[model samples]
Target: MPTSLNDWLRILENRMLYLSSEAAEQVRLSAKEGKCEGLPLRVAALVQEDGSFHYAIGFEDTPKDEDVRFSDKGVDLIVAPASAGNTGRSMYPFEEIDPATLASWLEKGESVRLIDVRSPAEYAQGIIEGGELMPLHLIPLQMPEAKEGEKLVIYCRTGMRSGQACGFLSQQGKDGALNLRGGIVAWAQQGLPISRADKDVSVG
Candidate 1:
């Protein structure tokens, strides 16, 4: 629930690698037994072209520029931007923003383009405030005319479709399109403001 992009990235850095205290202690002991005792632990996940994921964990003397660096339970952890799509098979250059940051953007009067990648029926049931209905299937066609400098954020019911949409936009050489992590479900769960129309009666 971070209100800014930097805060959101910091949260992601800490949560991306769930190193328990026991695990950290084990790593520390293992490192001490080995010659490279003080080296920092680097954890990375990559999505392959065949819709598969690969993960790596090891000690590194230096961190990459794009790596999100932080500590969890006394264990140093680093995550690269390439690992954003680790939860799925598709990999692209888009980023993920949390609901609180999106809310903060709106509250600060920032010009952000919010696109709802859900179906019309689903959108009618409930939608994030200021989100325009832009079904996932039509993103390729409609996104061509998007403003160059606008920050575009897409979301679906549970973030699956929106992630795909973000990947598609990234592939098209578009910049500044981000997926809303956990989608509108996460948004409402955080008590963020949403808009519901009378056309739908079901809860998504």
Candidate 2:
């Protein structure tokens, strides 16, 4: 039992990708057969009628605008926004934060540094309280640092690009980098209020 998001982050990062050499070769061959060579493997979790889950993997030529891409051992993995939620941990190349869990973090007054990695126009619509606007394109240029025991939570419109940000941050050895599972849509769905970008600035 990992109690903190940071703990969960470490656990998930190690499990993001698991492919034996032979399996990797087989996947490449299958992609070539399907005329999907050079395309990324789009993975998703499907909920079965029995309330269990089935993991789906395929080579996707067309990906959504908000999709996140990760490279593991030369294989590109494509993931759609909110797609990670089907699996409890999101299994993207980074740690994921559920909207409800985040709300609880805020309620408990935990140290969380929230970042909104979306375009300026997208960020203006409404943002999670205390979110600092650091557009996805600008993440590399202006990444945030977390203090001891502070969680670095990043999100975009659909939790896709922000997931990319988390991957980048983790590569930089930054801990507690969590992506909001479904972005703001999921947040609003949980009855969590979105506030002005200037108000409720808790993490400074």
Compared with the true structure, all predictions reach lDDT values of: 0.66, 0.66
- lDDT tens digits by residue: candidate 2, 1-204: 233344334434544544445446655755675577897877554443554333334566566665566776677776543332443232324557689999999999999999887767667779988888887667778768788889889987766567667756655666457878778878998899998765343331
Per-candidate TM-scores read 0.54, 0.56
The Cα error of candidate 2 at residue 47, in Å, is: 19
| Count of steric clashes across candidates, in order | 0, 0
What would the TM-score be for candidate 1 when compared with the true structure? Answer: 0.54
The superposed Cα distance between candidate 2 and the true structure at residue 105, in angstroms, equals 0.6
Off by over 4 Å in 1: 1-90, 144-149, 197-204
